[model samples]
Target: MSNTKNTAHGQVQETSSKSSSGTRKPIVLMSMGAQERAGHEYQVMTKKYMRPLVEHAGCVPVLAPTCFGSNDLALYLSMVDGVYLTGAGSNIDPSLYGQENLTPEKTQDQDRDRFDLPLIHAALAMGLPLFGICRGMQELNVALGGDMYQKLYAIPGMREHREDYSASVAQQYADVHTVKMVPDTWFASLMQQAEIPVNSLHGQGIKTLGKGLQALAHAEDGLIEAVHLPECEQFTLGVQWHPEWQAAQNPFSIRMFQAFGDACRQTVEKKSRN
Candidate 1:
């Protein structure tokens, strides 16, 4: 069932739609990128990120186009129970955090960077359940006054975290390293373990922890793998890994999605009473 209505401008409007079970599924607002395919610009979001939100999280995913900008950010946030910031093929523009374009030749989604950064703040201000993956996590950090390493591998003592393009797709996404969860953190308790195997696939990594954000897990190389606002009672989290990839098959990914789903459900309940 579709949970959104389309406007002539290509923006989406949320609907009070219910599934066949006579219950409304929690709606998640996913930010989209403005990309050109075959000489035409398109609002695009990867399909992998939507699957776990539907299959495991029991929510209806809705797209928020980057072309529309921040004029309607509040209206969009008000219509959904959660916000999901997904990864992209292009990197965020470095100027957002007072840095020069160190990687000018690399592709950059400036439109998305402009929109999603403000969307992150509006979602947090509204106390919506927020989840970010890969580039999404970096966006969240920058929005909250943090910075990133443009090229993670070039840093002294930092290991190469980019995926092996030469390997098979499954092999490239397969677990390649381990991350140690901080004891007593949500992740450690959720997984019930100290260390968990994870896949690494990114050229950029967090260099400074965002304000009010705490590290939930870290790779053996000391790179922060997961972060959350410790003071935020709502579900506000960002992970450096791509848990949405084959998420249904991974136990850790399943738990993460379920937790996010539960948080979205709680938001629905709270909004219903208001």
Candidate 2:
């Protein structure tokens, strides 16, 4: 019933013989939990939609709450083979990218920024696979010295990316746009297609790509739909759509997770050998 074999500290304990005692699963730490509820005041925790998708990817998805301090953060980073910065209702504080929250209401996750920004940097520094979706993508760009348009809709020529509130969850997540792949990119290599349709749901988007990152795909209206860190030499990628939604049903979505799973597996093997 589980995809993980056995894991710990970013390593997968794979046994060569039948008598092996234990095997640690390769865990991919998801930095999320319960944010806020109608009657609740404080966001006791954080949560993500990427859990089941990561599990489908063939690794353990561990919830990493919004923790503080360098020491504690280091511990979280060390225990996982990869990081999946899940999308949230909040947006990265504009201040991080040298802008004020043009619309404070649209900017809700400063607390999250404190943990996620550093997490992205640390994961990349260690060369662990890092993937971002929606808000996660914006955080990655900001963390790597890129900027985002506070309100994507406000920007001329940009189409609406938010899901319609009235529709059911399935209808809301319907793929409404086509994202064409940029030639000669890692994402393209995985897809092996000129373009593919993807579901869109976000309030903000990248204005300038972060340092060492490159666009992998763009929407019909010319917005960057996906990006990757070619220089990192690890699996560092992001997409504006919600691939986690019914991921197992789509070839593109399944391929994305499989790639991440492969990266996690590779990390486990490297650690096991060392």
Candidate 3:
């Protein structure tokens, strides 16, 4: 292992040689948000908001671009210590979730799903710490045999989670509703609170949790706001909010990243020893 280096185009990975005891940050492979940029097709990238949070928590950020095949996937799984799945402007294609009622207005990033879904399962199988936000959570659920409500507001009791298009960014992310924490749940134990207010930025949410996973928090309308895989050996927690947007100032958001960073340190250290 040498100093921090670039292994591939648009990819950044840091090794143990340049890191310190408490600073020997583990390389966390973050799944990119895909979309066509300018005239380029399949422009693989991630939001800038997620970087500082992971770095402040003692972890190195690396872009895990859409791995196109099994060999690429295998290479990444062996290189990184943890995974962070970020929110996206696109939605997972309805076909993957056994539903086909995708509204024409709903954006779909098929390229992102192809790699993210497989990465989720692979990381979980190998006991790697994984954290997902918004679309990331939805993909986690679908990857584990779960389904989602395409438009939660359509339900009789479900509150609309979409933000007002005209509101300022601050107003949109402002606490719009409350989510009650389930007692004795994995997230409850870490968050150490009974309830939390989160930003509403998605129309889709987990309608049915995947196998081996349980709801950690729910909205007043009974819509799941967070999920955790209790049976998993490694750390796994997915929230239906954009914590990265204000992770540095938000208490809950900070805790989430810090906890994940600790897990990543342990995972990488163990892997290095082996």
Which one is best on lDDT?
A: 1
lDDT of 1: 0.89
Go through the candidates in order and give each one's C-alpha lDDT.
0.89, 0.79, 0.80
Candidate 2 lDDT tens digits, 230-255: 77878888999988888768889889
Q: After superposition, which runs of candidate 3 have C-alpha atoms over 4 Å from their true positions? A: 1-23, 42-48, 67-70
Residue 198, model 3: Cα distance from true site in angstroms: 1.1
Pairs that collide in candidate 3 are none
The RMSD of every model to the true structure, in order and in angstroms, is: 5.5, 5.8, 4.8
Give candidate 1's error at residue 213 in angstroms. Answer: 0.8
Which is the better candidate, 1 or 2, if ranked by lDDT?
1
Off by over 4 Å in 2: 1-24, 38-48, 67-71
For model 2, where is the 10-residue window of minimal lDDT?
15-24
For 108-212, candidate 3 gives per-residue lDDT tens digits of: 877678888888888998899998889889999999989989878788878889999899989988888888999987678778889987888898989888888
Model 3 clash count equals 0
